[model samples]
Target: MLKEETVRALEQTARQLRVEILKMLNTAKSGHTGGSLSAIDALTALYFHQMRHDPSNPKWEDRDRFVLSKGHAAPALYACLAEAGYFSRDDLKTLRRFGSHLQGHPDMNKTPGVEVCTGSLGQGLSQAVGLAIASKLAGRSARIYSLLGDGEVQEGQIWEATMAAAHFKLDNLCVILDHNGLQIDGEVEKVMNVGPLGPKFLSFNWHVLEVDGHDIQAICQALENADETEGRPTMIIARTVKGKGVPFFEHKASYHGVPPSDDELTRALEHLGHS
Candidate 1:
């Protein structure tokens, strides 16, 4: 169990990151808001607690790698990266703007902390598998982590990667599915059902675990369990709400690819205690 103080601190950090994500999206006027907000808590737990990364030495050879498989949630990753000191938080305002390193999707060549280029869905897991294989071959202790959307899992390539990860016994790899229930179109079940994820991953020979995505302690505990498990990759199905912290946006599909408006931004900031 995590210390109460530590959990409180992480929760506070996540709330602050939520504020940042809303601000970034509202400024860009055209980024995914709901998914970004939905995934912030998990991303926050990983960057602030689980992952071994150096902001000043981002290229450090032994550091763990994080891939945002659902790259439309780039705002969430960008906020975490900035808070981790990979870049200036001020740069977050430049998200999705022309010539900004923080583009609509993650670019390895552009972003300081991003491990791989991920925009097209269903590809990030494969990249993470490759990185895990490389780390094993190189005898490095670096672990590879990736986040995928429930809707994004509808792609066949994800299954292929799932099979490959098990075949290779990529135990150093951990993938979190951001099961936020809704995508751009509508509810995941209504659009294209992908439930019972635990059994599916288990059949693929993955060690499956489920957790409340917004609970920092639960997330951290699951991550720690992943670290201990051997001979199979772990799939953490994190159940989350679409738009987590904002009252108007929560679970609303309309906010998926839409940024907050001027008035919405003001209300959101006030709700987040940002003033």
Candidate 2:
């Protein structure tokens, strides 16, 4: 569980992550912004308050693993990793640049802290299931966490992986769904609705929890509860706004993958009290 002081610290870290995310997106000129911002708080809570990871020993066998299945939100993951001391914050400016480790989508082979190379939607849950099975077979107590997008869950593979995870009874695995209700084209319901997400996961024999994605306290609680759950994988359905914190962008479909212009960035930073 996270102490009050730790939660405060994480709030600061989340703010820093948001700043880095904006800078990185501005530098890249091409990346998902809305989704990334929406998931930042949850990522902050996990890397800063919940996960057992080692920055100096990225490949430590006993360390917890995290997979950003919603690969388009790589900026959030990269920012969290940097704040957690996995890499230098300077590297963030190079995001999506030619030959930079910070690619548009996470590349595990190139990035120190990323566990899986994910960008194709619906594949991350499968990868997490494999990691969980491996940990169990190796007699390791480390847990595995995967963050997925609600729109991505429309893919058939996710449900298939969900079935496999329950079949294997990988209680050490936790899946978080960023339910922001927006996709690239338009609202998630208009693109390809994946509603009743909680019931769907429950029917698949997984433990399902719901929380506000922006609430760090709720995020920590869901994670802690996942640790206590037995005999099944846990899925957290986190309802979130597309562009949390930035008022002009919140729930705005145009900001999904669009970067803020110089003027817009300035206004956004001002709104966030960065100025």
Candidate 3:
């Protein structure tokens, strides 16, 4: 179990990251807000506590890698990378701006800490799987991590990658599902149900774990558990709210692809204790 102080610190960091995410999205005036907000806590646990990465040496050969499979949540990854010192936090204001490194989707060539060009949806898991295979072949201890959206599971390519990850026994790969239950069109089930996810992944031979996505200690413990498991890739199904922090936005499908307005930003900051 994590110490109380450590858990509080992590929770504080996640709150701060959420603030950054909201500010960046509001600045851009165009970005995915709901999914990004939903995924930030799990990302906070990974980048701040779990993953072994060097911000100054982002290209370090032995470093663990992270892939944002649900690339629309780029703001969540961007917030973590900036906090981790991959780039200037001030650069966050440039998100989605023309020629800014913080684009609508992750681009490895453009972003300092991004591992692969993503946002194609369903392709990032395969890329992560390939990275795991390469690390294993090279005898490197680096682990590969990826995040997926519950709605994204509707894509067949995710399953293909799932099968491949298990077939290769890529024990080094861990994937987290941002099970926020709502996508752009509507509630995930109404659009296309993808529940009973645990059994499905287990059927593909993955080691499955479920947790509250917003609980910092639970997330960290699950990650630690993934590290200790062997002979199969692990799938962490993280149950989360669509818009986590702000009362008005929480679980609202309308906010999925909408950035916060100036007034909304003020309200959000107040709710987040940033005002």
**lDDT by residue for model 2 over 189-222, one digit each (tens)?**
9887788899999999999999999889899999
lDDT-wise, the better of 2 and 3 is: 3
Model 1, which residues run further than 4 Å from truth? none
Listed per candidate, the RMSD to the true structure in angstroms reads 0.7, 1.0, 0.7
Error of 3 at 149 (Å): 0.4
lDDT of 1 by residue, 179-250 (tens): 999987898988988777899999999999999999999999999999999999999999999999999999
Every model's TM-score: 0.99, 0.98, 0.99
Candidate 2: which stretches are off by over 4 Å?
A: none
lDDT of 3 by residue, 132-181 (tens): 99999999999999999998999999999999999999999999999999
Clashing pairs in 1: none
lDDT of each: 0.95, 0.92, 0.95
